[model samples]
Target chain A: MNNRNVILVIGAFVVHLLLQVLVFKDIVMFNVAFCFIYVGFLLLLPFEMNNMALVVIGFIAGITVDIFYDSLGIHASATVFMMFIRGQWVKLITPRGGYEVGAAPTIKAMGFQWFSGYVLPLLFLHQFVLFFVEASGFGLFFFTISKVLSSTIFTFIVLVLGQYLFYTKKASA
Target chain B: MRRLLLFLLRHRAFLLFLFLEIICGWLIVQNNSYQSATFFNSSNSIAANILSVSNDVTSYFSLRTENKDLAQEIARLQAKLDEKPKEVILVDSTTNIAEIDTLEESRYEFQTAEVINNSTRRFNNYLTIDKGSVDGVLPNMGVVGGGGVVGKIKYTSNHYSVVTSLLHADFYISSKVKDKINLCSTKWDHLDPSYASLLFVPKHINLQVGDTVVTSGFNSIYPEDVPIGVVSTVQIPEEATFFNAKIKLVNDFSRLSYVHIVQNLMRNEKDSLESLIQPENE
Candidate 1:
């Protein structure tokens, strides 16, 4: 809707791309870097961005990562669904339009506490659906659960780090 | 109606999220196997390239270890050669075998080849070797490395063939105990490639930890008596008929370079007769 929003979207997308190509791969010690790329779109959606658009972005983000990880559609689908819950996350955390003008609700924009609300629930949902779909549903119940919980923690930590690095507390508007 | 409209407006994101989740769920269901995506191609291709590069750098580093293993294998083979040679000449199995017969010796022809590409991490995994049909690497031949059975050949071109790693859920190898006292199927537990489980061995059998497990080679993908792994842990869940024996693999699939692809000289004759006996392949 505005210049700042476009920049955020474009900038986050670029960061997501670089993360996939250069980082978050093969270094299994952190394991959570597996889905950290999607956090770019997860953290940077514009304040006035439509929920449907965000979902689409999530889907796109998931699919893009899936393409490289060779995990197939597991990511695309998980991410789109993640985008779906983000609005309620914003509302629950900051209420109506709590974000400053032209500033996102990332860690830099809304501080750590504000971003945590967005991070935790969405991270849980994204990972749960992601792992569930990846396991083809309900087969190894404990495995799917462990994967979700571990991956959620990993995704959250990386997303927070990305937000700290990327988000800016500015009002171009 | 007005309440519904207000609810929809207030909770649009939740509603949409649910919808997208449903779509993802449906797509997952459509894929019968929880096939991790084709992202493997990109990562694997790059990784294969990186491995080739790293193989260049690390080959120099690992030459000592590789040479050490090779030296050990040579010593072992020399020791085996010192044993009294048993008389094992194959007669016509169908007609003359009824008269007088001792234990059939496992015939094996070894072909040396370099490991071109291999992967242990992915769901549906494949390994390629430099030697192929041109080098007498026919389909269904057994491949071994680091004193452990790696896998069987799936397909072959002139110079290369795809061998499915035993680490793959889709890959199953017929194997059992060395003494033929216990028979079980070997499988990767999907936890680690370095460890696999010997399924369907009943709890009734005496399976101690550190017992050697080898290829019984009944159906003959591999020669009888090739090493697989040692029993790491034995589990007897009360609800199951089979004892779950964990096997600590002897081969390090990650750092593989050279291997011995074994050719069964009598495979075709055995297979043709086998097809006539059973309607379905065991």
Candidate 2:
């Protein structure tokens, strides 16, 4: 990515982290659905970004958020795992012409159908690992599963809305 | 060696992921254990400061309820003060002077703290208070709200402390049914924030709905007879040895703005004496 894009991504990272801890932290619906909007930062990173860089950024973001949540390592492990798998997920869904270099996987960049396919499963996996690990095991199997599903849908809705409001359709570098 | 090096290079990313996951697993395990005093929690200065600012803004919305609770607390204290003289007169006639002197020396000291951040929807919940080590607040101290017991101090920094909320899955407090000597444990069932399960009550004990539960003070963390909750439901399954009872917690955890950290002044002496007897039993 270029210097300007790097700066922009960093800015988004701080914004997402701050909004997650300060605003979205308290907004749980019926004690099941949680809005973890910070995951959107990882999901929307440029496709061509280095896997190592992505994993490191995920670790930093997760740990910072973990401090605020008082859930040390749970968020970090989930985010890093998702970031590690992101490269493969991107490769698995390559379009016929392939993605443009340095293209972000935003809804504006990729159409709604492709974007949902790309983001939904990844968000599901992230929430799955997060809630189960926080609960320590499948001891509360059904309850934890419900939490994961609801949180995934809640986070996905917020992420899409955030992208629609803020992200502009920029030509790939 | 060359082939091994190639394999290592090919899977370096996976190796990093494994290594980091191990670290996270270690942190989760370490943090789950009692009183580890880690610096990565919300009690850290930067996170606590941000939460404090956010709380300052949002707390204004709950000011009316907070004032009402405080006024009620004041009225309760006034009522107790009015009865103190008659109790002292009866005690003077019935008890020895030495016993009265010992009773007058209060064992628990309370320090007021503002809750800067709190969470209730998680499997494990915590609250960060604006008081810390500098304020004489330490880990393992009991925190109580005006209404009832809140939680215990989990960690303390210089100016902030994290309390393990009573709603936490791992949290358990020694409690007993009001006016009955039978002791039971109060544990969060992880289903609802307002209710917690009362465990270990014998089947023969007559447990009724709406029975008040209070801290037994068996562990010396909380003061004896402090209001915990009222038993809301009691069920005895067939062939079970214990009754399955639930209590509606007295403290409204979501609206918690302030708490008092109870420091047991004689805790060190009691703990040291107890430690001396443990080895003999072993």
Candidate 3:
């Protein structure tokens, strides 16, 4: 919205991408699970941002990770799919009171239960599309599903921990 | 017309999503288009540089193992050299020494390279070597490592080349069982990096475990008699006419660090001469 918020968003994008490319890119657990915490950049964007903008941001983030992973457009396709469905997901999980204007749907703003409910499905969807696209196109069926499930859980844990460690609750709320 | 335009304007976001998704799908599935896709793959200069630097750091950890492999190779060569020299006596009085020497010239040139980037996890694996077109490396050259045949060069940038490893799904090499007339083709199943399958072996040929497979030299790409693997399993279905043979690869692909690209000097000549051979009457 404002100059400060735009700067903050850009800063977060760079930090998330750096960590993804430099750190998380190589973090394959037991040769099964991969942690993709960079999806947090899209998950935490301010509410009411245009869906088109969300998709573009998701594309940029996905491609950034892809450049390092050497998996062209696999992550981008999954990220775009998740962002395309994010609007419906938000409406489905909306609280009775509804989200406040200009507030990000983050753990600090939306509370632990709301944030988990909001993030879990989107995260799973992203990982599912990613691993399946990667596996079905190039690997076996059952092996890919296992990779998808394990990577989803791994990514979820990292995103939850990241939210708690980085964002604090609003004091005046 | 206005209504149609308004509908398109309203669903433009969805249209954009579909458009971008199509591009993504194209990139994922059509990664085999090598000419226009160097930038997206690891063969690009920036990606290759980063991988090379990382390899430099990791290569130190394997220095001891590499030394052992090098020692074993030298010992093998030394043993071959120490064997009794068998001189061929020129019985033909008309044959000159100069002409005979020219016939013995080498047909293949080799250049060493380091494996800067390699992967064994994917169905179609590729290796990036530090040597490229600038270093006399070219597409279609055969690569070999510590044990035996590795792969063939797929593409080459200025300073880097991408090798489609033998473990890739599409890689197949013509081989023969050592000391036998049996010829077969070998291919990886993408299930295990260390094992591959031997096809087209006749049912009449009795196969035993640990029979070595080597290049047949029928293909211009690889030299003859380069050891490829050894037979690990042989299965004969009750009514089948061919033997299903499993081979354990000689090269440890997962630990590959160094390789040599075989630059065949007579490839063009051989190919042209072979292409001129036509069927008798058909």
Give per-residue CA lDDT, model 1, range B115-184, as digits (tens). 7656565444457676766787776788887787888776565665656677766666677766545478
Clashing residue pairs found in predicted model 2: none
Query: What RMSD does each model have against the real structure?
Result: 7.0, 1.7, 4.0
Model 2 Cα lDDT, one tens digit per residue, A39-59: 998888898887788888888
TM-score of 3: 0.83
Model 2 lDDT at residue B38: 91
Worst 10 residues of 2 chain B by lDDT: B96-105
DockQ of each: 0.32, 0.86, 0.49
Residues A20-120 of candidate 3: C-alpha lDDT, one tens digit per residue: 75567657786678888789888888887888898888887887767556577888999999998897788888899888988888877778898888888
For all candidates, what are the clash counts?
Answer: 6, 0, 0
Candidate 3 segments whose C-alpha is farther than 4 A from its true place? A1-27, A37-48, A64-70, A100-120, A135-139, A158-173, B33-37, B87-105, B277-282
Fnat scores for every prediction: 0.45, 0.77, 0.53
For residue B46, what is the lDDT in candidate 2?
96
- The model with the greater DockQ, 2 or 3, is 2
Candidate 2 lDDT over residue span B128-243, tens digit each: 99999999988999999967999999999999999999989888999999876458999998888899999999987889998999999878899988899999998999999999
Which of 1 and 2 is the better model by TM-score? 2
Q: Model 3 over residues B29-102: C-alpha lDDT tens digits?
A: 77655534356666678878877887888789899999999999899888867762333335444773323343
Q: Which digits, one per residue and each the tens of the lDDT, describe model 1 over residues A1-173?
A: 76755775677687766555344543343322244555656656667777777877787677566544434467778777667667656666675655666556666656677667667887888778776665554866885577678767776777766555644434232
CA lDDT, every model vs. true structure:
0.67, 0.90, 0.81
